[model samples]
Target chain A: MTIPDTVEAREAVDLLDRTRALVQPELRGACDTLPGPMRRVAMYHFGWEEADGTPAAGAGGKAVRPALVLAACQALGGDPDRAVRAAAAVELAHNFTLLHDDVIDEDVTRRHRPTAWTVFGTADAVLAGDAMLALAVRLLAEDPWPRSAEASARLSDCVIELCAGQQIDCAFEERPPEEVTPEECIGMATAKTGALLGASCAIGALYAGAGEREVRAMDAFGREAGLAFQFIDDLIGIWGDPERTGKPAGADLAARKKSLPVVAALASGTRAGAELAELYRGPMGAAAVARAADAVERAGGRDWAQSQAAERMSKAVGELARAVPDLGAAGGLLSLAEFVTRRNR
Target chain B: MTIPDTVEAREAVDLLDRTRALVQPELRGACDTLPGPMRRVAMYHFGWEEADGTPAAGAGGKAVRPALVLAACQALGGDPDRAVRAAAAVELAHNFTLLHDDVIDEDVTRRHRPTAWTVFGTADAVLAGDAMLALAVRLLAEDPWPRSAEASARLSDCVIELCAGQQIDCAFEERPPEEVTPEECIGMATAKTGALLGASCAIGALYAGAGEREVRAMDAFGREAGLAFQFIDDLIGIWGDPERTGKPAGADLAARKKSLPVVAALASGTRAGAELAELYRGPMGAAAVARAADAVERAGGRDWAQSQAAERMSKAVGELARAVPDLGAAGGLLSLAEFVTRRNR
Candidate 1:
């Protein structure tokens, strides 16, 4: 069941693309009843328009969560179409979080244009996010999944934890540098990023009539995958190619984001930790970010983050191994997991 | 089984007082996990503390929505405790909307204190509101109602419509005033204000094993009551006592808010409409608000709102009559509806 390399990555992407084509129209139809401005803002965020509401193409990101959902359902011996609504629900929830996250993080640009908050105002963005969250839940509820009640409940639980995780993240931002730990960072990432992905897989399995044990295993697999995904993300934040990342190199360092690598470095309590702390305490600039990045690299922070990513990747594969030992579709999932954790973009 | 008017309003207040006591601790526990500034801002919005988070007494508003939920359950022959979590869920959802509404409206004050965004910054307020919304949904999903699945689905539907309603509301604010109509305003109010209230009553009825017909009737009752509530609120917004309202009289007019009454007057295109259009076209100062209020009063806006309130109250009562004809403990519910639509405060 193990996927050997990136060959299957393109297939996974194709599956995701097909899923998006099926769901995008439905998603747009749901918003048609909304007020014009709100609908326009949502359409813009969903990559259907320019900020001025002019028609456009390609506003959405990779529909990774939905792909995982449909693949897991198929791998578990269920028709992927039966889980299409659920897949769309998870994707909508993911994008809703992204929209809010952009505003909360004060990120002005997304997908090479102004963020929703910048164009429509934060108030409008807040309402739009709320609307999308509600829509996600409704989509799940309306879908004809087996054990619909349980699946709906699972989705709601993930949303709640997602919010709590976000709260924990924002709370961490304001704390003195000493309060942040690698463990705390991981905990936040698991809740904020991992919980929904895990729930997506678990719910898909549940819909496929997977037993409780298998569901739990899939949950663990997705959670581990999410952690690995985030660890790699943290790494890329510092050292990713500008062309791939679409941001300046070392953007995380420039923003003084207390990411996994920085937390690990500080936890090491080495010379790098002292220098990192001083850099964090001061106003972060381009020069400061470069210096801090160099210091962390010199002090083994990058190596530590890489090791953590490798460890989590192994754990993710281990969980998938336990969850689905003999399924042919498992290869694609494993390959996708690897791609998620190792991709430079 | 109708409760006698001899039963004082204090009796209803006492039930809410007790429910508040039970929920306040839980709400505070959730907020405590946030950063210091966020916690303080949330506390202030909850009427728990000053802007700085110092402990204060008698700061919270009436827990009306929770009380309605509990009362509806008891009246419909269900255990109030079984509905308590849902009650808290509805209340939290209501407050979550309030927090975001304050931000969207850019109101500097709420419950006679600096608004959460004004005190904690807009980012914090948005995050806090989003967190509360997530918590509300979680409470409903986790609460072990007799029909937990149905209840969860119902709640999710309500939240989505509520968000849509808010979107419509914000959209209206930016458009040319002429583009908005009284019918559109009512539609927005029904979605934004009526949906959750209707869901609360419907959930209560569902818990009580009320058949679909009964649930539909109760939903209608709640929706009518909610519309009535808004109509009366519009009346109060222009003329209620400042001491009771915690704001100056005619605050909505002061802000040029397009409430139902104003929309009605504007749609009439009479002398009052002309005056209102003039005042709304420019910045509304104290004199303008006073003049507009006088014009509305003269042009029958106030009377028209009152008449609409009466019609809605009658419709709500009729729905209640069909839903629970025997009355029984639902006596309290009937009284609660009347009280909600008639309250001066």
Candidate 2:
């Protein structure tokens, strides 16, 4: 079923809650090993502590990457407990990217609080991000399981892909609106968003003692689902409810970000596409942002992104079936994938 | 001899040149694998290419860390050729730290050229640095040698130490002149400079199939030598031949850096120490910088650092004896260590 029933949605949220419970203790244990100054920034960045060093309720990630790791391992009949460290490693890698990306983007707020860089200053934040990445590799490399080396290698490679993705995305911002192609935009999005998600699954499969074929299929499954999630996310960037998103409508357009749907609209070769590109050339006011959103829809970017999301989700299931022949066994992974795309709906 | 004889100095140069020849090909091959944008920044950072991406005579690092690795490998009676990738990995990790450090410190020059962050902008340099760090881990993790796992883990741990060191160093800049202790400065220097150098030797030993005792001794040797080098470097930062050092005399004093010797002088509890602390309270012009330099010397910082260097070098040789008792087997390693401390003279 393309649509998640209300009960299915509840199950997905429950799975995420269970993953947070399963993964947080080990994650905290790992953070405790950081040197004092770095430990302070990292603890605050993860929302385990306030910037003042007091405990907080922790508005960190939804643990999607970690959940995917454990779910993939369980789907393959592997003990999820054995993969907890790997799950934590994946989450650390994810947060490392977030910290650096925030500094690079100069975006201040994250998880409804100030970003690490804003609270700790850019130098401490950058150093903390670097430490988190090295910590991720250390956790995997120190594992007693022989296959952990492979997982570490895979994660490092994913980190490189992420840096490239973020680099390209930043480069895109400096170029003329018409200069970027939809293909290039998609490639950047895949590198930035999908690579780590896929790596999380592949690492999970490796920990489950899966061979090359199964691991590759699991990676493909996660990548497809991740892209699907990205498409939905980009849609929300343009048309998200201000109350729900906690930002203005068309916030991405206001910033003139070369997001997926906007890139599609710019390259659509319609009158609206040309108008949208013209509007992108200057600072956007509220009226301009609203008009830009309308032009994107008229240029067919909205329809295209929606259909692509649905198509990608379909492909994701196909890949999932290849990795896990028994669909029933993959319930957790399916729930996670759906939960990510179901956010806007 | 505390000072290198003419032949000994020549031998040290030759060993470094040989290490460069052996490691450059693998390092280039590894760098060539980076994505397009990152490859450009990394190439320029390593001085392999001009900013326009044209080939240039590289003015990169002196290949000190890689030399340590190969020399330590040979000293352990292992084939140094087998450790080339690990040597390259260590160098990559070193440069990764350099790129980010330059950004954080806002230093404009490195290796007598504009730093990567200055040339390519901060975001690209940071991304390139992130990629290089991952590439370092990837290089070791991909090695078929079973011991590469231990080496990779060691390198990751070293990176974390480096981050912590840099973080603390930056924090020191924010505190009052009298707030920091010399012991804390030494700890930061050991973490920042000594940890990676020690890791290089330890990893070399691991690749050579050395046991725990030999590896620990080798690491100690590198750490002591690294601290000695740091003391000499700090002395040069304050007082050195401007022509040879490629900067003004008292460069560190002018910048108000909380380098080791400066911290020592500030904590000296003497009249000149109070005068130096007063000078540190605000920005220093040329005349003020000269006065600060005189105050530090009058506070006994210069003599303290020189004596400490000699003491650390003695300890380094003692540690080297434990790792390679034959002594003759470690000629190259010994030469490299002596050459680093001999820079001031």
Candidate 3:
């Protein structure tokens, strides 16, 4: 597909297409080494194959995390080609979380397909996820790169944070909405969503042989951008167009999810916030979902999330500038960060 | 604990106690770095603390895998001290599997206490297990040892095999009793149980700076011994004293578990084999379980398993001799191999 400069995200989209060209083979090769059952589940999860073992039009992720890795490496004047394996490893780790998260959250649809757990049994999905995680670590451990050990350690630490994020998120769901503070919600989002993105950039920087200060800055950039992306994603979850998102309107509210906006609304100290809390207390019909969405908007949740996302994007750009003073040299990283948060879906 | 020379397994018992002393601090230090929620779950699972966050006497595992690591290092004339971190990493990986297996199998008890899942919930247990897997990798990645990277790679590969073994085992549980062959059962046992033990010994050899050939031999020794250990464990599952085993008599039959002996009996071309198959078709009460056990014995499964264990033990000794040249130099490893398969439980 031709990506012209006429589109705002054309550069990022072109970079993603190129990243897929480079990293997909690595990802597929690593997954191919898994046992037959796990390989099938992983292939299906990545949209490389249908449930019947037939090839499919791969509807896998957008390769955003991998794009960050390559772009971050290139931004530091490092060869992006040398970081393809690292990029693939990050993608595998990301998908591993997705597989297990779908099981934990009981999510049915992902990337416009039935979730792996819904297609395969829960046990199979979990085991396949386990294999992917080990595969990810193995990829780094076996890398000939000088920084592979540090990359592996950082990746492992990032996954532990991701687990903590997931554990806290689950615990939050079991508690009353009014009892959960917005600060805790943001902390969870940072760990759950921001961590892998940060690790991708940090690993890329390590591959670049960047100094500690530069690596730290690159990590912060990706993390802040990731949080911004999550905020936008939460907004889309509530108010996105069904035609574009392929999700029912207010589906998160219908499930009583303690999402960023929902939690913000619950703590807004307004009558609408009380109403939103009451709605979250029991099963919700479509009408109730619409009311909850309206309540969130009236309680200043929608505005707060919008401002926070914009603030996070600015912070991300500042951190990127810290690492790459000549912004012209970091166009790809900037474009990718902007592209993730700018998506309407 | 006094370990007298007269007792058959005294040397092995002494080695395990020393291994626990050396590896427990490393294990605890790694667990201490986990996030609060995951740390709590892990501590409880390891019998380091009670469910309520108070300290408890550590009734954790017997340090069998770690003991093998140290002993293998000693057998190859290497300093066992250098491999303590690797040993701890292996133990962490093993416990990670135990946590997930309990959740998957829905087993309610572990180490005479309620399982982590039963106490905390499946979500927490699963997250905690995921954290531990990453922690295991992280420990090796952060090690200062020259061969830490290779060890990490081997451990990760072993975990992938472990997942395959577990996946196959769960698949077998869903099939008919007569459908699972004895060979398939043994293969699963090797993959599930033998792979980690093999990796442990191989890593120990690596830490010792042993050549590849010696490492391979050490791994084979551990694998054969692990298979023998499984055979003996399967026997104890059926005919051992419940008081010693901490399980009820005929428990495997009560659950209709397609264990090695059970599969061997079902595959035997005898009247008793047919009788056992018929009994396996439905839930077995106490009397039916007793009759099924008697039929397994009549079908020659007992003798076959006993002989198989002895044969594997002989192979394990041969492999050890190949690695160490002089059998006297490998007393520690030999004692460990003997101790595992010789246990009544």
Candidate 4:
């Protein structure tokens, strides 16, 4: 149960490898009863094949969430093998949100291929996502997991919170600029991004017979980790290299996305904030995007976001330290948390 | 417990009325976190308010699904009061599907008002639907009932099957006419419609500690009832008057929906079949829709669908008889089944 280092995190890698085998088959098995086009689109997203149902590879995601689940279970004196299904369930739920989020965001590409909606159409994508969520719940319900009742309840609450958070995100997009405050944005992000991560860790701990207080502490750690991850993601959305980020630099600027950094800067009331706000108020074009990025930078948005991310990362690590004293096999959990907070892409 | 006749069915109706009081507040409590516009749309769909968020009476649905759940429990000599939360959960799940389905189908109106999607936009509508689904699962998991594990598993499985059925329905829309068979259409309808109803009855029975055989029989009854209900709906989709159906006559025709009746006629090799296929090959204008409706009729699609509906209804009655010989206080359940098949709208 030795924890692997960041450079040699083969345990985490193997967990993801196992996750692909465990989850993709169940997913495909569920979709096998469906018609061809839907099966194809869903399969493609699962990284099994192409839109035409051709054999393909390297279409998988980073498996960040599942790794956290397994790692947290190990950290809490449980075998990762014992928590594999929980790990798989969390990943399935995570992907479910991604599929639907892509549709809601109207993003055509994911992981360097046409999205499920783009390939099979939006309705199919929506249903496929729904199917995945249902499968996640089913997996948790019918299993060797000792606390299926508690796990299922936790998972359902996370999902509901996730959707409510998504609704807030969508509604905020249509509102006037002043309506979205930094605190509100943080609240939305916490519910949207943090809830599932928290639930994942809590489920893992619950499976391991962790005490209620211990489970809550693990959940708090995971939640803080998730917020840190999202905060860094917001920073990366603006300032990261295009090659590393997989999209164009300043893409958030072009989309006029009010990320955490942007919101904080906008609320700062500096001259640069006024300029950034003015640029955002008008239609976002190429030149406007360039000027807006510059304005945001001058308003200290990037620095402020970086500092906030650092603070969150510190808080997350502190919580993790408080929750798991021995570390043991969960030392990998620490590495995974660092990976999430520090990753460029 | 004494069985109530249609005139005395008001007793069950009274139970439903009382249950609605509990559900409405809980439903709103779950949705309170959502932003104003999205909450407004959901409120409208919940029949709690008008599109403008103004208070309005007479906006609610019949709550038939919940009634079935409670009645099934009562029929099995279980306390209907104990099943109230689950009843609300099923109804919420039903509305969740309806909200998402409207968006996927590009439907602007439902229950003679603008759909949530049309009023609040697709993203918000989708998120709201997702929230409802999560809330439904949460309620099932949290509700204080005996046999909670079995109930949770049944609910999750039903939701998964429901999504699978929806995926097949969407996939059917994209397939060529030759590939769309009547059996396939029936399977889709079962998955989409039958699964939830079956799950509702089974869950209620399970909560009541009904024998496994009885639970299975109740599920069978629900499945057959759902098929019968859908068949009648297909018939009404074509021939029922707009005043009765609440939709324009031939509305399904204009949409070129591959419903049961249409699929049945397509399977039959006849002159009318050829004409119907030709008409469905392209968009159906008003005149073309009328022509297609006539073509289906000439091909005996109308008569064929009616016979199918009657056969299914008979089978459903037989299953219900086997499930609960006396049916006790659920005499209203039998009447509801009959009413479902006979309803014009």
Of the true interface contacts, what fraction does each candidate have?
0.43, 0.82, 0.87, 0.59
Worst 10 residues of 1 chain B by lDDT: B1-10
Error of 4 at B323 (Å): 2.2
How do all the candidates rank in terms of DockQ, highest first? 3, 2, 4, 1
Which one wins by lDDT: 2 or 4?
Answer: 2
**What TM-score, computed on C-alpha atoms, does each candidate reach?**
0.87, 0.96, 0.97, 0.89
Query: Which lDDT tens digits does candidate 4 get at residues B29-116?
Result: 7666545555676788876788777886743576767777877887888887788777877887888889989998788878767888
lDDT of 1 by residue, B150-265 (tens): 66667767876787788788779788775798899999999988888788888888777788998898888889999999999998999888877767989999878889888888
Candidate scoring better on TM-score of 1 and 4: 4
Instruction: Find the candidate with the highest DockQ and give its number.
Output: 3
Instruction: Please list the C-alpha lDDT of all candidates, in the order they appear.
Output: 0.78, 0.90, 0.91, 0.77
lDDT of 2 at A341: 86
Candidate 4: Cα lDDT at B177: 72
How badly does each model clash, as a count of residue pairs?
Answer: 1, 0, 0, 0
Q: How much is the lDDT of residue B281 in candidate 2?
A: 84
For candidate 4, lDDT tens digit of each residue in A102-129? 9998888787777888877788799878
- Candidate 4 — which residues are off by over 4 angstroms? A1-37, A175-180, A246-248, A278-295, A327-329, B1-38, B174-179, B241-243, B246-257, B274-298, B327-330
Q: Which structure is stronger by TM-score: 2 or 4?
A: 2
Of models 3 and 4, which has the larger TM-score? 3
Ranking by TM-score: 3, 2, 4, 1
